[model samples]
Each structure stands twice: as structure tokens, then as C-alpha cells.
Target: EKEVNSMIGRNPDFARRVAIDFSDNLASAKMLIPIPDDFPIMAGEILRVNTGLDIHLDANRRPVVALVGVSLMGVPIPNAWLGNMK
Candidate 1:
């Protein structure tokens, strides 16, 4: 996080335009966030997770998470997995 923060320090307008949604097509992470059995996991809900990142691009180019390996309960789902998830 320190590395990215450093870059933003010099530029004040960096935060003005966050093209977070632009990279929706390219998702480096596809995780299944844990939730209650009764609770529903919508596409929007999953992407809005506060798991620190957003999977966005500030300094790291093209989504920082490249690990296709799913982990414990894992991260929130990416846009590509919507059709696959029944």
C-alpha cells in the first residue's frame, strides 16, 4: 500500500478520477465471499466489498490480484463469474 500511496502524494488530481469500473472486464480475482445461508449475494453486492481493494489500478497495472487459486471463503466475486454462478 505504501508504494501506491507514494505515487498519489505528488499528484493531487489522482483521486479525482477513479476509473475503477473501467477494468470490470478484466478481473484478476474471483472469490466467493462468505455470507449467511439465507442472505443473497448479488453481483453489485459482491463487487462493493470493502476488502481493501478494490482490485483497482492506482499504481499497480491491470488488477493487482492475479491469483486464480480460490482460498478460504475467498474474496468477492468478479463480474465474469456471474453467468457461471447458479
Candidate 2:
């Protein structure tokens, strides 16, 4: 938890711009990905938006667990458009 908080503090822009949620079970969790109407949705965009949640568990007498989920709300493009170059 401390590591996650520290990461959020270090990257304020990422923390503010992304939509994040947490739940006890996968069935109960809901994620909303927003794509602008003006933006084009390519074939692979849906696959990119659908990310997985990682669950880490400890095997000690008293188990400890952590769940991390990241969802990208928009299609990501390269910093420079490939077609733009002559």
C-alpha cells in the first residue's frame, strides 16, 4: 500500500488522469473506459483497453494479499505519427 501511495505521489498526472477502482471480488468491480467521439477506434484498441488485475498472495501462516489493476481509458498513439514522416 505504501508503494502504491508513493507511486501516486510521484506521478500526480497519472493518478489524476486515470480512472481507478478497487473491489473485494472481480465480479463486483466495474471499470469505465472513455474514448472521445472525435477519436478513431482502431481494431486493436479494445484489446488494449481490457487490462488484467494482478493479485499477489503470501504463503505464510497468516496470508497477505494485494491486488493491482490498471486500465487505460483511451487508445495510445506513438509520440510521432509514423505516416507524418516523408
Candidate 3:
């Protein structure tokens, strides 16, 4: 989830790019994300999308529950992102 934190970093605009409402139950399930025909896609592909409550104390010493996780939406695209990719 470090990648997610880097993208969001408590920024509103960055956070909006990810879908936080998604259920945790759906995160682990393998889903097919159709992409361009030129690229060959093997069946039963998996993407690591997630959602969670990051509960911790801020600089002000107040409890904060921040929603954090990667929400890479599944859809037709040129390529799928892998964790090792830069």
C-alpha cells in the first residue's frame, strides 16, 4: 500500500483518482480487465487493489482514521500495472 500512500499523500486531488468506496471482499478476487487486442492477456489475471482505514495520530495528537489504498479501476486499457513496474 506504500504506492497508494505516495499517490495520495493526504492530497485531495490525488486521493480522488482512487475509488475508496470499493469493498474489501472484491480486492482479492481475480478479474479480467480487457485491454487492446494487440497485447496478449492470459486468463485469470490478478490485480492488487485495496482499501483500508489507516488509524493513527497526527502531529496535533488527535486520532485520525484515514481511508487509504490503491484503487486501480478495471477497464479497457493499453496495459495493466504491476507492483514491480516503475
Predicted candidate 2 versus true structure: per-residue lDDT over 42-62, tens digit per residue = 432322342334343456655
Candidate 3 per-residue lDDT over residues 1-86, each given as its tens digit: 55545555588764544443334322222222445555566335434344445566779999765443334454323223433331
- For candidate 3, the clash count comes to 0
Instruction: Report lDDT (CA) for all predictions.
Output: 0.38, 0.41, 0.44
RMSD of 2: 12.1
Candidate 1 C-alpha lDDT tens digits along 1-86 = 34444554456564332222214534332223435556665433323222222244557475454333222344555646645432
Clashing residue pairs in all predictions, respectively, total 0, 0, 0
Query: Clashing pairs in model 3?
Result: none
* Best-fitting candidate, scored by lDDT: 3
Which TM-score value belongs to model 3?
Answer: 0.23
Candidate 2 clashes between residue pairs 3 or more apart in a chain or in different chains: none
Residue 43's lDDT within candidate 2 is 30
Q: Assess the local accuracy of residue 38 in candidate 3 as a C-alpha lDDT between 0 and 100.
A: 57
